[model samples]
Every structure is written in C-alpha cells, then in structure tokens.
Target chain A: MKSLKALNNPLSTGQKQLDLLHKGTSETYKPPLFVDTIEPTGHFPMKAKGVEVLQINMGKMCNQVCKHCHVDAGPDRQEIMTRATLELCLNVLKNESITTVDLTGGAPEMNPEFRWFVTEASALGKHIIVRCNLTILLANKKYNDLPQFFKQHKVEVVSSLPHFSARRTDAQRGEGVFEKSIKALQMLNAVGYGSGDLLLNLVYNPSGAFLPPAQASLERDFKKKLKDQYGIEFGQLFAITNMPISRYLDYLVASGQYEDYMTQLVDAYNPMAVEHVMCRTTLSVGWDGQLYDCDFNQMLEINCSGTKNKHIADFDLEALENRNILLDQHCYGCTAGAGSSCGGEVV
Target chain B: MSKSYYEPSDLGKFGDIKDFQPELAEKFFGYYNSVFQEGALSEREKSLIALAVAHAVQCPYCIDAYTSTSLEKGSDEEEMMEAIHVAAAIKGGAALVHGVQMMNKAKDMSM
Candidate 1:
C-alpha cells in the first residue's frame, strides 16, 4: 500500500498539488513536538470535547482561483451531494438536536441545490452558516442576488476578506478581485448582511507565515476601521488560522516556507487552546457525505471510524460521538496561540 | 490545453528528508524571498500580501505568522480582514472554472 507520501514527486506540478492535499507542510517539515514543560503563552484545553455544530460540504463548485484553497474545489469537480444524500441530512437534522449547519465547498453557493438546502435548514430552525467567498456575488449574474437571498433567509454570512488593500488582495486572487469583493461586500451591507445589528460575520486569516493575533482585539480593530473607512459594517470578525493543506502546502513547498512555518506553529502550540478547537465540537461532512473528525481531517482523507458510515447518509450521532478524534501535527495550528476558527478565538 | 491535474502534493518527499536537497529548498527559498522582497512593494506590504496569499494557499503556519507580521507591520484590522476575501475569491474562482472542463467533457460526450 502506498503511503500517500510515497505517491508524491517534486518535479511534477500535478503530483505536487495533489500531495499537498493530504500532507500539509507538517508531515514533511518536522516541527518540534509540543513539550509540556514549556509554559504555554496562550491558553487552551488539552483535549477536545464534541459540540453540536453540523458541518456539510455542499459540493466543490466555486468561482475563484486563489492560491491557498484546501478543498481542491474548482468548477470541474463533480463530487456534489445528490438529493438522496441531502435527504439523509434533513432526516438527521429532524431527529438530532444539532444547532448549527455549516455549509462549505468551492463557494457552496455554486451548488445548484444550495438554496434548497439552506431553506430546508432554516425551516427546521437551525442556524445556517454559509462560508461565502465574497467575490462570488459579483462574478456572475446568477449570483447577483445572493446577498438578498442570504439576508431573506437570515443565514449567517461568514464571508472571507483577506486584507483591506487592493494590491495585496488582487495579487493573491487576481487582478480585479479586490474591486469586485468590495462591491459584493457593499451589496451584502445594502441587504443588511453586515449592517450594525445584522448577523453578518466576516472571516479573516493571515496572508503569510504565522499565527493570528488575539481575536477579540483584532475584531475591535477590524470593526472600527471598516466602519470608518468603507462604511462596511459587519457583526463580528473571525480570525481563523490557515490550515496547511492543498494548494497552500504547494505554495509552502514551492516557496520553501514549509519548515519555518511549521516550526512557528509547533513552537506556539498552547494546550490551553485545545479544549475550544472547532473539531472537538464540530463534525465535518464531506461533499460525498462522508464524516470526518474535522474539515482538516476530511481534506486528509481521515474519515470517522473504521466500521462507521463515513458519509452523511449513514450519519449516526451516537456512533460519531463515541469515536476518538484523528489528529496530527496540523492539529497544532488550531491549538496555537489564542487558537482560531470561523468564530474567532477558541479559548 | 488545460493540464487538468497538477497537484503540489506530488512533491511531498522533498520535505521528508532531514536535510532537504538544499539546492532545491534554496531555490524555493530564493523565489520566496524574491516574492516578499521590497520592490514595488515594501516588506510590510509583502507581509500583508503573503498573509492573504497564505490563506489563499491555506497554510496554517503562514496564516499564523503572516497574521501577526501583518499587524506588526502596521496593517490595520480592516486591511488584514480584506486580504482574506482576496484569498476566498481566487480559491472560489479556481473551483468554479473547473466547471468548464466538466462542461466541455459533457458536451463532447453528448455530441
């Protein structure tokens, strides 16, 4: 059996990219293991406890081509959920006390059935979170009304904004992406998505080699500046750490930042932040309905237990709850410093 | 002709070696330094860009370092937050365009 790493080759770009999907920089660049004697600068619990948030990967259809995406999501991917799989999800939602439904993908909105799922979840009174890539709203005519749609259904908009500068944003994404993202954000604001008192949330992750700043303090700064400069009002700013996976690992390997970056994460590992790690409370569902310990694990193809049904169709809350987490060095990222997730600081 | 399947994951072995093929790592490091160097962009500017690029690429370590570096280099909160959207857009768009491949294949098979 080929260990996934056995399949990689530095010379081939395609192989390199695929390898990145499974072995984020952590595997290759060995960071010092988190030693207990060193007092952790930031606080987080040592072990993770499960929470009731239900995460679902709608599909792999997206509109942007950023460099660091972990999903390997693109327009060509066909691994979408069938109506049957979605039905299984709804059944679980009805029976389970799950409070949050997190929808992801290559811009989950690209799914043909995205709205149907969102509407169904809303009807069930579940808090719906759409991990939106803001520019999608401005890419095509079909997506023009997404802000209105999200607002109408009261779906919490967890959108990403890499930075405030046009040059930096455009370089990472493409030429005109900054202008378009701003337009879409303004649209969301117009529809009350980011206006004060609205439930709109903007996600922030660093652009380069380190952990994020303290979430609360960062959010304060974000709120004030966005409000003052662009009049872009958002409810909360989530400072998530970028997990080393997929294209990102490729970027790290290609640019030789993999080792130093991994070292930084391991050095910053804080056990106190572990308890609040999103994986403890959240169960990530893949596009094919497979169950993963967390989104990062899913990308690595580490599914729930050997005997359990990994797909959503086979969702068993009790069985999943009993399964131990699948962890690795990448887990350090979630436990470092103040910790990071879609909701800001974990600890 | 879209190569369709180019993944960096193929290069996993390079990182596994205790002492990497220094020449190779050096090459990558060189490109990296060049990417972040002060040219049209300042080191501070490059750090912010790197932070957003880190998210676009999804490297947790880069995310951790660049986030702090960006802030340290005077990137305000709004600026850093905005950089993430840039990553999201490119990532999302990359996924969406692959649909063209699917569409082409579907059309070819149908025709």
Candidate 2:
C-alpha cells in the first residue's frame, strides 16, 4: 500500500482529489452519528431484501478524474480486474437468478478486457448496465467507437452529467470535459442508444455538498436543454445525492463544510426511503472480486457484513441473502430525500 | 426571562411554540408541514425560498433552521449564499425606495 503522503504529494489534479478524500477520512472531524438517526426511526440494522442487480467495479483506470468521484479512480491507479476475477463474476451471474449486471469503474471501458466481459455478460441473457463516463469515448482514438459497441451489446449506458451547462459540468469534471461529453452523447444518440429500446440514462450528482433537486423535474430540464441546445437525447435522468465518502468527503473537510453536510444528511433522513435502497436489491463487486453491500462501502473498504461469502468466487446465495447490509455515516446519502441508488431515486 | 432580548438557545426550542398556545401552534405547525411538501415547488426549492425569507425577515431562528434546511434539500453553499443576496437586495431596495417619500416630503415643505 502506498503511504498517504506519497500518494497525495506532487498534487496533480487527480492526486489533489485523492488527497482531499484522504483528508476527509482523518480523525479530526466527527461524522454525525448515523446509526442513532436510523435506529430511532426503527430502521436499524438494515438488511437486504434480495439481489437483483450485481454491480461490478471493473477497474480504477479512468481518463478524467472528477473532483467528486467516489471511486478515487484515475489514470495512475492500475487496479484493473483480472480475467480470473471476471470469470468468477460471470460464473456467479450465470448460476444466480440475478437480472441485471451493472458495470462501473474509474471508467469500466478502460479495462483491456472490458469489451470481452461485456460480450460474455450479454451472452448470459442478462440486462447489462454500464456506468460510463461519457468523456472516455472521446479520450482516445481506440475508444471513439464505444458508442456503437454499446449499442451492439444492447448495454444500458448510464453516464454522469453533473449539470446541463458546460461551465458547471466542466467545473466539477475538468476543462473542456463538457465539450467532449457533449460529443460523446451525440455519438451515442447517432447510434440510437438513447432512442426507443436502447437505454441511455444520464446521472446527475450535485457539484457541491448538496442534495440533487427532484429527479422528475431535473430530467425534464435535462431533456429540454440537451435537445434544444445540443440536439441530444436520453432516456432518463437520475438525480443522485453525493455520498459523503472518498473525493466528496475530502471536499467537505477542505471547505470546512463536513460537519454541516453530515448534519444536513442526518436532518433529511427519510425512513420511507430505507426499504427501497439499492443495497436491499443489489450487490457490489469490487475490482478484486470482493463483495460489498454497495459501491460506497467498497470505496470505504467495508466488506459485506458477514464473515462468509465475502468474495465473489466464494459467492453463496443463501449466506448473502441473510447478510445484514452494513450501515455507516455514509448511508445517510442514500436514505436522504426521495432516496438515491444506481437506478436513481428509489422512492 | 434573561436580560437579553433574544436568547440563542430559544432557536432550538422552536417546537415549544405549542406550549404557549396548543390549538394555534398545532394549526401553524400543520400548515408549515404542508407548505414544505413536494408540489408546485420541490422541497429543495422551498428550502431555498425559506432561506431567502429567513434573511429578509431577519429571524435568527429561521435563518439557522432554513440554512440547514436548504443544505438538507441539496442547495449548495453558492446557491444558499445567492439566495441570501436576493433577500438582501429586496430588503435594501425596500428601504431605499422609501427614500422617495422622504424626498417628496422635503420638496413640499421647502415650497
């Protein structure tokens, strides 16, 4: 493991983002008591309902390192999933009754065998969902044809567009990212990816330490703006609340807003949102094939609640079905407002 | 009960309004709840509006409540501060506009 100082020093764009996330995890600031808030609402020890979506973190190699990325993924980080791990994930998907296979990463498409894995997963007659950073498609010549490839595989592409405007989008991502992303979306649109059956979902996470506006309203705004301004189209807009972990955590602490943000999340805790949380119906697989309740937990290095069935290779459906969904201060992000998930607002 | 006109701690006791007049407080709290729900404006939009109103009214209790409420509803610091400025502008403009009346009165008296 690299030391914190070594990984964070020289403060490149990605490194600065990494350093912020690291600084957030320091012991100086106390996270609002997460369990106390939930327990009082009789939603303590949140448990999984069943596994419907198997979300896999393909790798931590991404082109653009967004400031609020929870994965802490970047170009320098070389933690790609091996063929062996991919095989194990496939094996589980093959045998289990899982309906959706959601792929995520620094950019899942960055993995060398990303296409191969998608091909195999698609062959399994499963609903494949890829969490793509649209800028990746325009990052290099080799990746330029990714939109067509996604269309070929019938993969549901869920890309993050922080805001509709370039100024705000580029501010959170990087300079010129908005332009590249717009081009990529146009490419996807050209291939009918956002049309009738080919699902193209856009995700909206707040640029700062705030919850997103209502998903339906934001979706309408995104649809109208993208159509009129850029002649772009998409299926749905998922309004996601930024989880207080990783890069975002670093941001809150650096700006002296960590405590306030946590308090806000705690205050907005909606008991009704607990039952429909993605963790209840989804399982997250890390790059190394370790199983977690959700992606945020995987980032925090929190494994599944139980001692057994911790790895995807040793996946036991029964053990996992009974496993308690791990809870932490970060869980507040998911339960707040209408609730947040990979599928967007749960409630 | 204390010497100061405003007690900082009273902000936390906002719910204690019921203790003074149960019927009116109940009705007021009920209306407040209905006002904040998602409808024509989202809970988030309402929070921002509330934060602006809090500043305009110069209510310390409402300022603290709505500031947190605005953040809870997912309004960023930039947006929150902007909302405050909107309030400040309106409040300042209201006071400034009243100067026209003073000017008119001075002209009449001088004549």
Candidate 3:
C-alpha cells in the first residue's frame, strides 16, 4: 500500500473510485437486485451504509485530469450543481431521513456553493462527507484553508492517493501531485483531522485495469508507509475497483486491455456483493440534479428508474426506495471481490 | 485461431485441462488452488517466489501470470525486479560452480 494510489473516480470525488470490462455483455441484469428492493433493516453499520448518504456531484471541474478519470473532469469543464439544485438537495435532507451528505465532484471545492451546501447540511444535523482530491487544497491560495474549514464542519474527508510512490502517482494523476498531496495530508493532520472523531480517510483504487487488494491490510500498509515516510496519519483506506468509464474506458480500449479487464471483472463477479452495492442504499445525484442508482450510472446518464422521482426537486425517499436500481457492465466494478462503494468494501 | 505453440490467451484457460481429464485435473487443480492460499509465506511473497521460479524454469506463461499477480498484490517494480535478479543470480552461480569440475578435469588430464 506504500503507493496504492487509488483512482477514486468522480470515481467518488463523488466515488473517491471503478473499472471497465471492455468485451462481453453476457449477464444482463434483472434490474440488479439492490438491497433497497429488499426490505433494508437499516442494520448495516458500514459507513455510507443504510438508506441514507445523499451523494451530490457538486461539479465537473477539477484541477487534475487523471488517467482513469470516470468523470472526465478537467479545468475546461464548466458544469456544476447550482445553488438552486443544492437547495433542493438540502430540502431532501431536511424533510427526508437521509443521514449523510456526501459531496463529490471533479473537485467539489471548485463549486461556488460547495461550502454553503456543507454548512447547510451540517446545520441539519446530517453527517457530511467530502471526496477531496488532496492536491486541490494546494491548487490555490484561496483553497489552502480547506482543512480548517473541513474541520469546522466536521466533514469526513475522503481523498484519493492512487499510490504512495511519486513517480507512479504522477503518472496517473499529474506532475507534483504526490508532493502536494503529502503536504495537504500533513496540513489535514495538523488540524487534528485524522485524529479523534475528526475523520480523514484515504482512497486507494488501482491505477491500471486491476482490482484492489484487501482493504484492512492495505490500510495497514498505508498507515505504516505514510507514518514512516512522512509522519502522516489517516483513519482508513477505501480500496475501490476502477470502473471502465470515461477516460478509464478510453484507456482500456486504446491499450487493448479492455477485453482482458472485462474478463477479469466477469470472472471475479461476486454475487454476494450484489445485494449491498452502493446503489441499493446510496442515491447518486448528478450536478444538474438528476438522480441515478450510483455514480457510475450518473456518469452514463442512467437516471433513477422504476419511479418518476428522477430529480432533486422530485425527491421521494419512499418512491426511490421502491424503485428498481439500474445495472450495466460498469456495475461489475462495484461487485467484484469485497465490493467497492463510496465507503469502500461493501461486504 | 491460435497460430503459435504458446498462445498467451491459453493462460486464461488454465482450467481447461479439466475438459480432457475431469477426475485427475480436478484433484490437481484443487491442490494447486490450495497451494496459493494465504499460508506461512503470504500470497504476495508466494507470487514473487513464483515469478523467480518462472524465470528459473523459463516458463513464459508462468512469468506472465506471476508478473501480473505480483503487481496486483502490491509488489512495486523494484521489488519484482529484485526477485528476478535473485533467480538470475542462482542460475549464474550454478553454472560458475560447475567450473570447479572443469578445473578438476583439466588438472587430472594434464600437468
């Protein structure tokens, strides 16, 4: 885990990660049996668990254009959730029983209303999670104070590191990202973020077309490496599978790894992971306020199904719970092995 | 469609040996799978060892398989290259050690 550098796709900056299967579309899903379809006992204690975690993609603008970016996010992209849409999301959290407000994006901080949404959601007594891309904190002097702001709101910060080595991390994310990320992480630690209840977590998705190793052990490696090398400390590690979408999918096809990667996903598909996939509990809201089963679907423009409540304005916890979750090839990125979600390791 | 004696895709079908001999292949594969599980030497370590052995045996298929395995298991490039070097050192040492026999034969034959 010294250099695990997870892709954590829009791959949760709404995902914090996903992978692609290039060739076969053999096992068509019967609306992929999401746990919401079944009676959720609300017993699962995993983070981002339960019928909550209102994940909103704040924008598609980012400081870095990662190689496996599922969002295809970059500086040129101007799309972002407006304050109006964020108000609708806040309204849903206000009335409905949603417990977590997960903010992600090309870089959620880049959104004009990002801090406003977090403050409003925090005021609502809902737990907040920010899928930070560590280097963004150092992207500009204006954003430099992000760690303190995050601490003030008690936001759970989940940033993708991809790998611990500078060369490899730079290869995937951008030049000098690893150094800046380290500085950002140290700043977060200085603010007492990764200690006590002020949570700070790291995301590790495979840089290439491969599944992540075990999470718990990987977390241990990350802890040792960061602590040893940089005296940095964090809470946990989320090992997300890289979803084949956007830039990642494009990489797969160009490199001719798509077919083999897809075969790996198909072979490693764990039915046990299907029931607890993030879409079952977590509702994905795009920048424009459209709803989908998960972030992957949001990227593919597969809106909320089996119900008409497909936008933040038409928010309906009951209807959404009863709706059939959409499924496709990219979903295998979530179900393979222990399962990948915003929280990481679903099973 | 295969045009070579060693098709890389065949590695994906290592299980296909079962199609020809179900009983024996099943037994061998059962043991093979068990052999690679988390044992005294972690799976990552085993993968590196497999890589070294693959080089020693010069098995293209195993080299390809274990290289990918080692990478996914969190072995960095340096670590993997070091493993290969270990195999190379042994192979080189084995040949040099045989030079002692040559020395003995030369001494016995003349002078």
- List the candidates ranked by lDDT, beginning with the highest: 2, 3, 1
Each model's C-alpha lDDT?
Answer: 0.72, 0.83, 0.80
Q: Tens-digit lDDT track for model 1 on A218-282?
A: 67666776778788888877887777776566566778887767766777776677667787778
What's the distance in Å from true for residue A78, model 1?
A: 3.1
Query: Model 3 residue B94 lDDT?
Result: 98
Q: Which one wins on TM-score?
A: 3
Number of the top lDDT candidate: 2
Q: Could you give candidate 3's per-residue lDDT for residues A132-246 as a string of tens digits?
A: 9999998899999999999999999999998777776787898899999999999999999888999999998887777888787667767887899999999989988998777
Candidate 1 vs. true structure, TM-score: 0.70
Write the candidate numbers in order of decreasing TM-score.
Answer: 3, 2, 1
Candidate 1 Cα errors over 4 Å, as ranges: A1-29, A33-48, B1-111
* lDDT at position A164, candidate 2: 76
Pick by DockQ: which candidate is best? 3
What TM-score, computed on C-alpha atoms, does each candidate reach?
0.70, 0.79, 0.85
